[model samples]
Target: MTTPRPVDCWLTDMDGVLVHEETAIPGAAEFIAALRESGRRFLVMTNNSIYTPRDLSARLAASGIDVPEDAIWTSAMATAQFLDDQRPGGSAYVVGEAGLTTALYEVGYTMSERDPDYVVLGETRTYSFEAITKAIRLIEGGARFIATNPDVSGPSQQGTLPATGSVAALITAATGRKPYYVGKPNPLMMRSALNRIDAHSETTVMVGDRMDTDVVSGLEAGLRTILVLTGSTSRARVENFPYRPTRVVESVADIVPLVTEFAPVTGPEY
Candidate 1:
């Protein structure tokens, strides 16, 4: 067993660890407040590329979490950073919301439908057949493929909704090219967040609800991982995975005291 380090920074998932479907989870507010009050560097990460950071911030605020826009990091931002690093001033034919497109634009990427460098796929409420068709044609025309995340379905009050991975699969079936998914479980997304905060993986803790994505990615990135059972995975299911988190708790509420006890105070508490 790898010994856990004291937490100096944090990377938490938005959906399960902090909130669930527009509702803030119990104790989530206290945990975030602790982080902010302690002046510990942290970022609320999400794989959903449907909304920009500002949009997410506003949504979280409405849900009772007072996270600022800059404190949130999305897969869209990661994808844009990846693309910008790979090819500065590149062009892409994007099929996503303002979240993905805006990030790309900020990074100096141009939206093009004519044989662009890449065909980027992301989350959208309506996956237009016309856009998917365009993406397929572009990929067949020799453009590379990229997607924000591999989540096939997302939770909703009504039911499961087809997500980015499902749409990416459809494109793959036609083009025979798998996209480079840049979200959770990729490790790149974790690395990107760490870089954003200038935090080292050795001193950072990752809190998430899924073993396949959050725990694995954090472990690979050399961060202590915490699995919260407030969302998708259950207690019994934790053992099913070959890997395990540093600790497993019932929810974010349960971890607040642990964080307080373990977190080193960098500044005087208010």
Candidate 2:
């Protein structure tokens, strides 16, 4: 077997690995502190395209996670980066919150309903039927479709709420155009995050909670993956997936010591 490089960079999911809802998981703050003290390049990543990095930073701070705005990577930002590379100075008919719009604007993208280059869909609190209808019409008129993530639903105090993927499906049913998702489960999200931190996948580790989204994406992106049990997928259920993460721990707390214990993972690669 080839000798693996030392893990010098880290990419982690925000919601499950660090904070669960409004509370910070145990050792999450220390985990960040350890990464910072170790001088490791890292990013706190999320698929929620509703809030910008600054907004997310404040939220994480409130939850006691203290991640910087620039250190956070969101689906909105990845989507913007993707569109900017695909078609610079493009136009879009967006159906998301300020996060998506702001990212697009920062990338020199214009928003319009009149024959826009793309119909970009993202996460929002209140998805407007009127807005979705307009997006469908624009798509039918030859606009490409793009979405932030593939999560069909999100969590809330009230209960499960329909998210971007659900709405994107609605538009697909109407316009026969499936959107290209830019968030978790798509290796592009990992690649974009890697590029944002100027980190190489060979020497980076991706820590997340879900087997499907986090593990699979990191595996495909050529990074070692660590699965935590404090989220959606349980250890017992991990074997259900055809692919696997490099390591599995009870939570981020268990990963604190590994900040300085970098080594190549010898797990079989998919």
Candidate 3:
């Protein structure tokens, strides 16, 4: 067997690996601190497209995980980046919240309903039927479809909430146009996040909780992946999937020491 590549950069999912439904996961703060102190390139990734990075930072801070805005990479930002690269300064009919809108605007995208170039779907607490209807019409009128992520539902303070994938399905059923998703499970999101940090896949490691979204995406992106059993995925469910993460840990707490003691192994060290 070949020796494992030494990890010099890190990409981690925010929801399960760091915070769990408004609460900070065990050792999340320590892991973040270790990353910052290690001088290694690191980014906190999230499929949730509802909040901007700044908003997310504040929310994480409230949970005692003091990650900065620049350190957080959301699906909204990835979607914007993909659109910008595909067609810079293009227009879209968006059906989401401020997070998605702000990212698009920053990337030189215009919001319009009059024959827009694309109909972008994102996550929001309250999805409006009128907005979705307008999106369907625009899509039928020759607009391409795009979405932030494929998560059909997300955890909320009260309970489960319908997310971007669910709404995108509604639009697809109405217009017969499926959206190209730009978030987790779509390796594009992982590549985009890596690009943002100027990190290479060979030296990067992705830490996540969910087997479907986190591990699969990282594996497809050619990054070593770690699956932590502190969120949506359970230890028993991991074996059901054909693909496996590079490493599986009990929780984020188990990963803290790894980061803190990370050292590049060279020559006969293996």
Candidate 4:
């Protein structure tokens, strides 16, 4: 078995690991504050593409966790970056909220609902049949399909709502083409976040609640992964899973102490 390595930087998931449905988790704010005080560089990496970095930062601040705009990295940003790199100046027909639309626009990707070069899907609160129909039409008309993430649903204030993956699935069934996913569990998203901090895999650790997406993505990226049990994943799932995280804690609050003790000591002890 591979042993865990010390992390110079940390990448954290926002929803489950930090908070649940706009309510901050116990000790979460303090954990982030401690990290900030220690001068540790950490980025909030989220698969949710519904909010731009500024929007997300504001939301976090509202919840008592003061996060800067640039400290937050969303799949929307990753998707925009990917599109810019792959098909620069290509037109995109987007079926998502203001956040997704804003990111693409900021990146200079042309937006159109007809005869577009690409059809990008993200989580939209107002997902209507008309929206799906328009996306399907564009995709069938030969536009490349791109999805922000594979999350089928997400927890909201009311309950779980359909996520972008579900819409992408509908489009896939209609067009017979799989959309390219640009979120967690995808190495590109991880690489994008790491690039922001100029951090390497060996020196970075990814902390999240989901093993399938968060832990798996970090492991695939050669980064140490820490699974916090405050969200979707349960203790039972962790024990039975074939791929285990480098460390498993009850919540993000436990990370600093865990890492402090678990990280390798450099000098030889007397």
Give the lDDT of residue 270 in candidate 2. Answer: 26
Q: Name the weakest run of 10 consecutive residues (lDDT summed) in model 1.
A: 261-270
Global fold similarity of model 1 (TM-score): 0.95
Tens digit of lDDT per residue, candidate 3, span 132-238?
88888888889999999999998878888988889888888888889999999999999999998999998898989999999899989998888888888898998
Distance from true position, residue 76, model 2, in Å? 0.3
The 0-to-1 C-alpha lDDT of every candidate, in the order given, reads 0.91, 0.92, 0.89, 0.84
Q: Is candidate 1 or candidate 4 better by TM-score?
A: 1
For all candidates, the clash counts are 0, 0, 0, 0
Q: How well does candidate 3 score on lDDT at residue 23? A: 89
Residue 93 CA displacement from its true place in model 4, Å = 0.2
Q: How far is candidate 3 from the true structure (C-alpha RMSD, Å)?
A: 2.7
For candidate 1, write residues 1-270 as lDDT tens digits.
344457889999999988888889999998998888878899999999999999999998998888989899999999999999999999999999999999999999999998799999999998999999999999999999999999999988999999999999999999899999999999999999999999998899898999999989999998878888998889899889888787888889877886677753121111
* Deviation in Å, model 1, residue 198 alpha carbon: 0.4
Q: What lDDT is reached at residue 40 by model 4?
A: 71
Which pairs clash in model 3?
none
Best by TM-score: 2
For model 2, the local distance difference test gives 0.92
Residue pairs that clash (backbone atoms under 3 angstroms), model 4: none
